[model samples]
Target: MKILTTPDIPIATLFQNMREVYATCNVDVSWASEEVLNLPALNIVDVGTCILGSTTAEQNQLFTHRNSAGSNDIVIYFVEATDPPFNGCASHPLGMPGAVVVRTATQWTFAHEQGHVLGLNHVNDNDRLMTGNGTANITNPPPDLVASECNTMQASPITVNV
Candidate 1:
């Protein structure tokens, strides 16, 4: 995995939160490296509502840093902000698997966007991690991931056996 963040944002806590979230389902989260990008133009990205299966020019530019080793590694980008009402986005250009998370996003936002990349969709329940109501709106302290969702995540091509 790879993480790209602006120089001002600290992602240590976010990474810890993400590891904890995925660990609930027995999925280990590890990264080879993290890069602190200094691109001011990309510091604040305009994702245009983060519609699934589509991406903006800024998103395309940011995702271009994805690892090209053909290992299906995931890249997480931390930006200053996205369009209003969205804290993170999982939409990427074709053949690119990555997500963009804002600096102010909830702890679960990283995991939630990753769930989308792993083929999990929004459920209406607030107690679940995949809730479309927003991670900040989750009523439960640690959101739940049902068995089916876990299965979906493990079955994604990006997942591999240890």
Candidate 2:
């Protein structure tokens, strides 16, 4: 999966955290600036990022196809939640095909959001990256498990045209 991050600082850091997790799985992932989410390398998992307060209604309006785009492309918006939901959530009120908003600027929050993009539901096991209740110590898991478990979770990526 490939993630497209805007020029936001915290959002870029969140992408870095995802790279770390991908490394743990021994999975190769490549991301570009807000400009490139369609490179051939990124077959599945296209995510976009924007900062809190910086994103305007105009920007959100551009992605109107998300509601029923049919493509698996999901945009992840980094917003400051009035109160961070301890549990994981999708950015839009309608839920599916929208970005995942995180209240904090922490790396764990990004990882948690990425977990949603990867098709893993909230797992109660704290050791698992998908464990969605608050922050779990899942920054890095064993590399083999990352690749193996992640593949097991999503056999075919619904996103990405490849």
- lDDT, candidates in the order shown: 0.78, 0.44
Model 2 CA deviation exceeding 4 Å by range: 1-9, 32-70, 82-88, 91-96, 136-148, 159-162
What stretches of model 1 exceed 4 Å from their correct place? Answer: 1-10, 67-71
Best-matching candidate per lDDT: 1
15-108, model 1: which lDDT tens digit per residue? 7777887888888877666766666787677788777798999888888776443447777788777765478889887778888887778878
List the lowest-lDDT window of 10 residues for candidate 2.
Answer: 39-48
lDDT, model 1, position 7: 21
Per-prediction TM-score: 0.87, 0.52
